[model samples]
Target: MGVTLTDSAAKHVANFLQKRGKGIGLRLGVRTSGCSGMAYKLEFVDEVNEDDLIFETSGVKVVVDAKSLPYLEGMELDFAREGLNEGFKFNNPNVKDQCGCGESFNV
Candidate 1:
């Protein structure tokens, strides 16, 4: 399966894009950094690349590069407001381990 966004996450992204005024969707990718050797990267997409993979949920698009698909496959993007903290949460089934600070993970 590909990446998907929860309703709240999609709403959050959609609102952000609406405010920004120009974006096709959101891009999800992986980067080699942090204590666990891999980290999640998210960005707004104004243009779709030729090799990009796009998944849609709740009317919002979740884009991923081919290279990042394996690690991010079957992941769920969630938005939550816990107390004063608000952010996107990645529920990745492929993640075998993650760092203590919760900034990074490894398959």
Candidate 2:
């Protein structure tokens, strides 16, 4: 399985890249922190690493490092707007539970 991006997510990323004019793609990963033990990380990548895995959806490149691939496989990223709030949401199948504050998860 591979990472995926919802149409809304892809468009959101593409728009940001276009406005910034320097990123090759978006990078996704997890870090050891937060109340639930793990938290998602997102960044703009100017270059791809040797062990990086790339998945494309709706013409946007979603890159992940090899170490993060297992945990992130089959995940879908989405962008949403809820009243006055808007942000990227992760639909991770590997997640077993999330913390009450919604900033992190446990797999």
Candidate 3:
């Protein structure tokens, strides 16, 4: 399995890209930091690297570098709103634990 986006996430990303007018897609990755030892990184890509792996879902492009593919495979990105708060949520099957602040995870 590869990366996927929820309908809400796809819509949100598409709208943002429309306003920005330059992005080719969204890039997802992981970095070594945070309390749980790893944290998610998200960015809009204007260009994709030749080695990048690309996945498409719900009309949105999800790009991941080869190095990050193992960590992010099978992940579902979602847009969520909870009362006064709203943001992107990651449903990562590889994750084994998450920090209390919800900013990082261990796999």
Candidate 4:
């Protein structure tokens, strides 16, 4: 399976793109960092690489590089608000464990 965005996530990204006015979509990737060795990276894409894999959910396009596909496949992106905190959350099936601080994961 490929990456997907929950309705809330799609709506949030759509709103951001609308506000920014120059994005093609959102980019999802992983970086080598943090205690658990891997961390998620997200950004708005104004331009896409030719090799990027594009998936659409709720009318929003999500772009991911081929190198990140194995790590991010089947992941579900969500947006949530918890009291005073709010942000994007990753529901990654590939994650075996996460660090205690909740900053990174091992897959």
- Cα lDDT of model 3 by residue, 9-107, tens digit: 999999999999989889999999899999999999999999899999877899999999899989999999999999999999999999999999999
Candidate 2 yields a Cα-based lDDT of: 0.95
lDDT of each: 0.96, 0.95, 0.94, 0.95
Maximum-TM-score candidate: 1
Cα-lDDT of candidate 4: 0.95
Worst 10 residues of 4 by lDDT: 16-25
Residue 30 CA error for candidate 3 (Å)? 0.3
Ranking of candidates on lDDT, top first: 1, 4, 2, 3
RMSD of 4: 0.6
Backbone clash total for model 4 is 0
Task: In angstroms, give how far residue 71 of model 4 lies from its true place.
Answer: 0.3
TM-score of 3: 0.97
Q: What's model 2's TM-score?
A: 0.97
* Model 1: colliding residue pairs: none
Q: Number of clashing residue pairs in every model? A: 0, 0, 0, 0
TM-score of each: 0.98, 0.97, 0.97, 0.97
The better-scoring model by lDDT among 1 and 4 is 1
Candidate 1 RMSD to the real structure = 0.5
The runs of at least 3 residues in candidate 1 whose Cα sits more than 4 Å from the true structure, single-residue gaps closed, are: none
